[model samples]
Target: MAVKVSSQKDTYKATAVFLVLMGVLYLLDKWIDFSDYNLDWVMQKDTMLLYAAVTFLWFKSDKSVGLILAGIWLIQNIALVTALLGQVSTYLLPLTLLLIGVLLYWLSSK
Candidate 1:
């Protein structure tokens, strides 16, 4: 099926928002002292991409595309995400799979 023009526009808007947010975040990291907060992981590229993926999923009309991309990003960066979760890392995979399944079922129903 062909994508609607409005869907494409939404995707573009999502991308622009992601880029601008990332830029602001990077600058903030550089200029601010966040060491006490231990939020360095939030500035990582993988984390940013995950955020972008979620943003795309939220904004895109064709959710399957965003879902696929988000899944790929999650799979590829599982280690980073898991590490960020520390003691909760062991539950990450199962939770992620469950969430994906739910999202897929929901999207298919729509």
Candidate 2:
């Protein structure tokens, strides 16, 4: 099915929300000295979260192209999440993204 104009509007709104959320997180982390984590690591995590949210929102909107990108981002970050979390998270990386997708899909419905 073709994506409706309303879906496009939803996409834009989702993008705006995601960006604002990331900006706030970044500032809060710096302001609170949340962690002495590596900048690259944090950036990667943020990117993953951003795309996952966007992807789920876009999917229901019939935005196939965006879904491809979101899936790619999640795929690229899978190793990172696993390596950082280690054996304790043998399944966490995939599950995390899946959970994100499910949550975002549900949230977008409203």
Clashing pairs in 1: none
User: Which run of 10 residues does model 2 get worst, by summed lDDT?
Assistant: 34-43
Among all candidates shown, the one with the greatest lDDT: 1
Q: Give the CA lDDT, 0 to 100, for residue 26 in model 1.
A: 75
lDDT of 1 by residue, 40-90 (tens): 778866677678888888887777666777777878887777888898778
Q: Residues 1-110, candidate 2, lDDT per residue (tens digit)?
A: 34567776767776776677678767877776545655455545747565556745654465665667666775767777678899968677668868988999999999
Give the TM-scores of the predictions, in the order they appear: 0.63, 0.47
True-structure Cα RMSD, model 1 = 5.2
